[model samples]
Target chain A: MVPDDDTQTADERWLCAVLQRQGLEVEPARLAELARAQALLARYTEFLRQASPVSVRHLGQPHDA
Target chain B: MMPEADGDTPGLAQAARALRAGSLSSLELTRHCLARIAELDPGLNAFVTLTEERALAAARQADEELRAGHRRGPLHGIPLGLKDVIDLAGVPTSGQSSQLHGHVPMRNAAAVDRLEQAGAVLMGKLTTHEFAFGPPRWGPPGPPARNPWHAAHFAGGSSSGAAVAVASGMLLGALGSDSAGSVRSPAALCGVAGFKPTRARIDLRGSLPLAPSLDCLGPLARSVEDCALLYRALAQPGEDFWRADELPWGEIRGLKIGVVRSFLDERSGTSAPTRTAIGDAIATFEALGCEVRDVSLPAPWEWNAAGMVILLGEAFAYHEHWLRSRPQHYGAGLRDALLLGATLSAADYCRAQEHRQALSSNLDALLEDVDLLLCPIQASAAPPLDQLTTWGFLEKPSYGIAFNLSDNPALSVCCGFGPQGLPLALQLVGRRNDEITPLRAGHAYEQACEWHRRRPPL
Candidate 1:
């Protein structure tokens, strides 16, 4: 879970900036929500970073349509 | 001999036998199903649309064809429902979403086409989770289907109604699309048979896309034999169809079975009743002369996360346009869930894809010496509706998604009942395209035990 502190707020703002750059609308009604989701998804990427160590990467997989 | 349809509801295979023997006409079977739906659907909430007129017309045509010595195979004259996501030419495939309320397809989905070709009587569209992504958020279109075993409990989603309809005898068979445990979860919760064949075994054109890459259309019925019959009817043109009767049932003794014990370890907080049921099943298999061996599997969390990323990314890609144009049209649950995918980077999806391939290969390596892998589909019985949390699906680790990622054929068959009398199911997985092994094992186990014979108290 993302911590509740000053850093978290700053992180949310930074995440919001990246999302806006990614072409998202980031409307006021959904701004805070989308920012939190961005943080969570970033964590998913982080999971991949950790998983990469234990997981095999690209074992000659034939691309599935 | 004419089957005396006293009060008991015969399964699909038996009903088809009666229809072929001239003891039961399609019209009679259709009427019985319609009556049951009328009497029970008010409490069960199993359908989005009921095609009474068309079903009767189709049944009449089926009877005419059968009387003229024309048989379309096992599903002929059998009344069945399709998960609302399945397209049926002129019928609206609402998918329990208010957004698609007016959407109707011009052609039947490939799976639907196959069922029709086999002379199936299309009863109607059954309820599904909104967009096949979230649990029921009821309103506008219809109410979510409830478990017939205990009305207060949830019949699983996103294929909720398909399981409920079959459990309640409203339909002999159903077509449910499983992207991540949707079909199997519902079948286990409702105490019926659900088969998720190899990913490419059935085509999905015209079906509403949830996660295109992972989507599989499968059958949910009462017996493994019945599920196999439905699969035979819907099997892809050249895909290997596993016919249950053709396999040597006793060969199960020679095959090796692997049990994934870590999947239900205490750290996962699996329920006792479910664990006990699977334990009994493992012992039963051993007693029946099969060699059981313990197998180590990847952490459930890893497999669960792997499935979710692929699911979320693909789902967002499919619904991105609508989500942007008419966000309010989506139910609250799906709207938020789709938003998470909006932030997924291209690298993230690619990474998940890499993991997907890796995981499949790892599981394949483990199963190289084993004939089948057996595990529990659900860790507990169906909980009450109020007991479900909004984000529960995201938080929990799934037992069914690993095979989905591997593209292996997995089946959910009833193993036993919990103390509350709700059903628990055993998941049988087989090598890709080698679905016959699991079906034969399921048939043998089902024949030996009385689990599949039991039905919901409703």
Candidate 2:
């Protein structure tokens, strides 16, 4: 394929391409927007990975997780 | 016969008295509302559908019922609008999405059924953002609703039109749904009272859902009492229903109000106008003999982040089919958000729920010390609608969402005006299912000030 000119990372681009293969249509401009969202999710993932101070209170709380 | 223009719309309570005293006919009030909609809705665009015939018929039935002494209650013959997310029989419950534009329901949602039986006249459907995630213009099915207070500014969302209609007197009250501040945000911005009862206490059947875990239906009206009336009428059994009119407004004397100061502290994203307004409100609470104290909880952003994950996980499950099949039909803003929702794994979703549990328990513990928690409704007054970006909804932490995550009750009432004359308001949050105390505090505050009396200069 032609060299992609937008700023989406390869993984995000692959994710969009996979979604497109799954029949979800997205505009070219939306690829950049999707990348921004992925960046946010990255932050969220990092945030969630770290144990919160009150996380010990979560022991035996019967959470579905 | 009364003149077409009565200048200002009366509150639901005052109108009920006029109807009972034989001074006003339901048909007259209905016609007055229709006239107002016709004259003013081009600028406000609060209504997506005008059920003129249905409204008039309902009004006539109400008049007949009153004449026959079969009165319902305070909401009798009151003209109201439903946010388009609510399913009204035979009307297309668009949820402001193009995909749902042609999808009309054969039956009313349970909330709609109860409100109709209470003698509420259905004026029509108001606009929402695309599928209840909006500030009105995300390639949705209808026009963006304008703020009645300022024509060029935002009216908030997704209950943007619900708040506008009430503020502009196009309708006295409207039902607004909240997942993350949909009801209260617009209400605060539009200078009206927005109420979010505990989500679990009310029936959610037949209404569209953005996040089933956090979705709630509520009422926005001119005053706290009006909100309480709708709240009692809509609540299921054991939901702690009380008459706002009979609230002990005198209870303001000794109640300990917890002021969430961190939210208003430096760099908290609260604008100067909103800061001044909250400062004034705290002082007013002190003057009213309420003991105000600084209270802290985990940073609100943590709760906000947890809520977003839950909402996306749930909303994605509902919209996955559409996201795969008819993605083009959604607005770019909602489309991107939903697609991003695709990135959250089952692990992410489950962990988010775990986080939600923690946040809920934390909020519950935080409230054990205060009768009610005072918080800012918006970082600032309603900005111009043009400033909203496609991904704007996801960018910020909503103060209202924290309560939703905790399943607590919240009410947004106008605290005061900013220098630009736009409305600034606060959120009064109470313990889970403790709807009475917050309504009481809201009523007490609403009475001690003239904020609720001031309407948008439509």
Candidate 3:
């Protein structure tokens, strides 16, 4: 659950907006947990972005479409 | 009809031999499994559905065929289970989710068709994490499969029931789908042998997909030979498919084995027992005439990051519609996981794919030098169920996911027991499209060690 004060993270605030934009209404009880999951993915994606440009051969794979 | 085989549950190969010898009938074997399931499943929760009548009928037909000199193959008369995500015609393939509770597929999965063609009796649908994404938890239709090693501990996810059933002697062999370590993880924790063949080696049709690029179907069994037998039946023929005679078996001497020591580093959170078990495994390989050396790959967390991004993104793409239409239908753990995918962009997913190619290339290059890469499958023994969290992987790098990212054939075999008496496993990875090396190495390792001989206290 989201804390009442002082502990709300930027990830929590950003995720709230992202969910709202996607029309996903997360229960207040789960907002903090979802925010944590979002943050983890964000960290992972950020790590991947800094790695390298995607090769053309990879983009041609079946699921890449 | 022959009397039921007394003593412990026979491995798939042993059962096949007994059946062909006329000392054990398929009906007797099926009844043995049925009786065990009836007596044990209430506590293990390994099976979500039981097709006792169908199994009996199939077993009888197998017996008639054997008696008529129509032996199909090694799988003939063997009883096996399918992870709930794999379809068995006319049976509900729940994928262990509330949404798919009544969802029964009209046709058998390709693997199921092959198993049936090989004369294997289908015991029933085994439990799986919800849609193969949720953590091990009790929700929706039923509780998660309890680890046979320690009832209070988890049986590992996604393929939870497959490993539990195999470990508990409820099934001789079972098929479990893996995308990012599902099969190996469960098999490790449950102390069974599991083989994840190269990507798409087995036809994915009729099995639910967790990630199209990463998805693989594999076998879990009491021994590597049993796993190999099941693999031979399920895997589609390809340019690189292994012929029955091609398996190294006792010919694994002089093989080059690479130990990924970096995976055992403190950063990976590898427990001391797991590390010592892996060290002993290395020593055993050396004693068996394998040329072992230390090797390193890109950080495990790096591969894990790439794998997880692709997994979460692809899974979200598949579940988005249902998630939007009826979020309540999902377990909170899986629902939360799928929602994390929404945070990723197409760029993120594609970039991970690109990173995947680089990681695969690195592994391929390393395999050119080493015949097999040995590592720890799990960082530690199975944790108590109450200690598990949905996003626990975020905190610890999964040792098995790197192989999934690289599309390698990886085998998980029980190596030793931890201090808690729970099983610890070591992983052996082979080159892409080459499952024989890992299976051969695993089989040889089993012959050299007595770990696989120990059964769960259950």
Kindly list the per-residue Cα lDDT of model 2 for residues B1-458, writing each as its tens digit.
34224467878777877887778889989998898999999888888888999999999999999999988887788899999999899988888888886898999999999899899999999978878884456344777889999989999988999999999988889999999999999999999999999887668899998999899999999998888888877877573554523543456788888888767765567888898889988988898899899988766677667777788878888999988777778877787777777777776777677777887886677788788999897899998888876656566657888888888999998999988899999999988888888888899888888799986766
DockQ of each: 0.29, 0.37, 0.58
What are the per-residue Cα lDDT tens digits for candidate 3 across B1-458? 33334546888887888888898999888888888898889999999999899999999999999999999888898899999999999999888888886798999998899999999999999989989988875766878999999999989977999999999898999999999889999999999999999887899999998888889999999889889989998988776566642444767889999988778877777999999999999999999999999898987889889999989889989988887889989888888888888888888888888889988888899999999999988999999999997788776788888988888999999999998899999999998888888998999999999788898886
Model 3 residue pairs with clashes:
none
True-vs-predicted CA distance for residue B197, candidate 1, Å? 0.6
Model 2 alpha-carbon drift over 4 Å, by segment: A1-8, A17-23, A52-65, B1-6, B138-140, B243-249
Candidate order by TM-score, highest to lowest? 3, 2, 1
**Candidate 1 lDDT over residue span A3-61, tens digit each:** 23454467566655554554544445555665655565566677876666333464566
Q: Kindly list the per-residue Cα lDDT of model 1 for residues B1-458, writing each as its tens digit.
A: 32234565689989888888898999988988998899999999999999999999999999999999998887899899999999998999998888996998899999999999999999999999998887677677888899999999999988999999999889999999999888999999999999999988888887888988889999999999898888877887444544422433455776799998778676665688888888899988988789999888887778877788888999989888877677778887777778678767777787788888888998898789898999888878999998887666556778888888998999999999988889999899999987778888998889888798886887
lDDT of 3 at B349: 86
True contacts kept of each: 0.23, 0.21, 0.70
Lowest-scoring 10 consecutive residues by lDDT in candidate 1 chain B?
Answer: B239-248
Over the full model, what C-alpha lDDT does candidate 3 score relative to the true structure? 0.87
Going through the candidates in order, state the TM-score of chain A alone for each one: 0.50, 0.45, 0.62
RMSD of 2: 2.9
Instruction: Give lDDT per model, in order.
Output: 0.84, 0.82, 0.87
